[model samples]
Target: MKILHLDKNHPLLFEQLSQLGFQNDEDYTSSKEEVEAKINNYEGIVIRSRFDIDKTFLDAAKNLKFIARVGAGLESIDVEYAESKNITLIAAPEGNRNAVGEHALGMLLLLFNNLKQADSELKQGLWNREANRGTELDGKTVGIIGYGNMGKAFAKKLRGFEVEVLCYDIKENVGDQNAKQVTLEELQEKTDVLSLHIPWTEATDKMVNASFISKFKKPFWLLNTARGKCVVTTDLVQALKSGKILGAGLDVLEYEKGSFESLFTGNDLPEALQELMKMDNVLLSPHIAGWTVESKEKLAQVIVDKIKQLYGFGDDEKKILPPKEYGVSGLGGFFFKTKDPDHIKAWYKEHLGMNTDQYGWTFWWKDKEGNDCSTQWSPFKEDTNYFAPSEKPYMMNLRVKDLHKLLNQLKEEGVTVVGEVEEFSYGKFGWILDPEGNKLELWEPNDRAFL
Candidate 1:
């Protein structure tokens, strides 16, 4: 099989793929037209974020079978469109999970211990060790937002620090024996620090808003290694001004496109962001939390392994198997089962303007502007048989066109959509739940919408 490597210069990945007996070609940089022109020749395309993989590219890749992302985020690839064309999508979060987790931990420690102040003082020939005393993590309570691969890695690192870890995720009962499961409210009340590890989604974008920060009874440290727009910068700045939060360690900023040094210069920033940079309590990085040297090589190896697993290239040679129950498949979306299908369907129909049939077999919905809302379902028993222990009711995200209008309509219809309608660097979305206690997500894409 022919493999096309889009963003060249990864010698490790090149050597590894060569050893796998696959013919590989390097393209240091390819224009949209050029890549599309030759896409049909390769069976697999490996890329970073340099090139966009949209419908046009997918249409040209007649021989394409798999699209391997050398990094974690799939935001650059049109995943849904690729899946529709029966192309497998693969990402390597496992490779950089440790790197990101460690970076987040390092930022938190540096901010709390006032390491930056010490470095500044020492450089200027001053000693203020007593004034720059550090805080202890031994008896602290940390709240982790997302419980995915990165979240697990962060929790594992926190285990060595002897701190109590509480996690709140939309996915129910993600009970790690090491950490306690708690509600968002409990996390706000008891946590000494709150770390965000969620993806950029409708439910998570601008999640740390005014009300979210105001809900905290104690001044807590905030850490976000996730997407930049995960926290509302304006509201976080307000919190910092009023001292509602003790401090913040941010690896990603709200609008980070240009070089880090250029973006943070003098007064050419949003008023709220300008004030934030002046605060010694806030620590910021250039979204390099997961870009360690070791992680780069490991990410390449991880993607190569995923490619091998997809084709069953070497069964005799040991390989890191994917989750046993959830093998890779075309994203026909996910399967969800509700015990009270009728009640759930009716709730969705009445509140969220969804349409349901008499037999409760199929369901549909329209946004306020009358766009078709994608929907799907299967029998509860059948789904349980397929997706065992994870049979609990959870949210299923439906792609939508107008997020704001739908959120307002749901509010008018007496449905308590969890959060406000907000735009992110990635997309726009909102959240709501059905009567049977299943969360529902609505999303509207933006630039880099595929991920």
Candidate 2:
């Protein structure tokens, strides 16, 4: 099958897909019409908000089987029409949910502590503590709209805070222990902070307008990491002016272009957005709530995994890279020392889609002959003795087939062997030293059992 890439992503997305025998091409600078003119040539396409995949585009894609969007939302694509044509719309909400969660939390904390304002004042040499005094999140009620992957993630981040979390979603039974399910009316009545996490649907377009804001019993801070069109910008500005809304932290804005790559393409900024820019209490960012370095790679990986799964091609079903008959096949794992191992692990797992646990990330692939393989990525405590005998800050674990045989060969060649063979259910491990005295780990893996 031929796949067209409308927007570039991490190389792994292409690399992995190409490994599945798919012919891939990139057309980053082509117009939508130009792409449509040649759409029938490809069986699939990968995108990340470069342009809309409307009915017209779908109609032109006669042979297209799937549209794999590297990002979460499919609003830019005509989902209904695509589905009606039997085209699979693949979205990677799972990929960036954690990044969105962390970003929302950061924005909320910045607003609550007046951190942005305080930092600006300090930089300008205007330190007025009383004027910049902030509210505490500990006693507040945080109401989350649309309790899907993104909403649940934001609520989970609030677990450390002494705040009540309420979620309102059209889907029932979505409330978890981190947040209580509540009606929209009840949430409006009690929430001190309202976070929007819904998609851009007809029901949500301009959903948070004057009527919506007026229904709230008291003023509340607003956080929107969702679609910009969900909130009416003029109404939001009016609420901010009237103090009906204490403040707003918006990562997306109504004035954004369809592509979300530029805000106002060679045009003057809208009046409402201009007003928003001048407000000290308002915090704004580009549509980047989920645009973290880690998320870039994760999003690509998710799209790759989904595409592979869709076509019955996957890590366990095929070889990730060709294996050697003798010697190290590839890098088995990578480990490092960190001051905060737990936090590091959580960060990697959340932002990088590592799925790291107590031990760390176990990457699954396959060797030739379709045998499952595993590679580990982990971080240890700063003062740990894990990298013992050698004071190196890191270790390189190499995957080999015959650990004992290789160790014997190295010993005959006068190479230093650091340890005896250690066997486990998943694998056998042995340590050796390089000429420069840096310790290296060798693993004879039983990957099918390890997984």
Error of 2 at 211 (Å): 0.1
Worst 10 residues of 2 by lDDT: 317-326
- Go through the candidates in order and give each one's C-alpha lDDT: 0.77, 0.90
For every model shown, what is its TM-score relative to the native structure?
0.66, 0.71
Q: Write the per-residue lDDT of candidate 2 for residues 331-376, one digit (tens) a residue.
A: 8789889999999999987898789899889888866767777778
lDDT of 2 at 370: 77
**How far does residue 68 in candidate 1 sit from its true spot (Å)?**
1.0
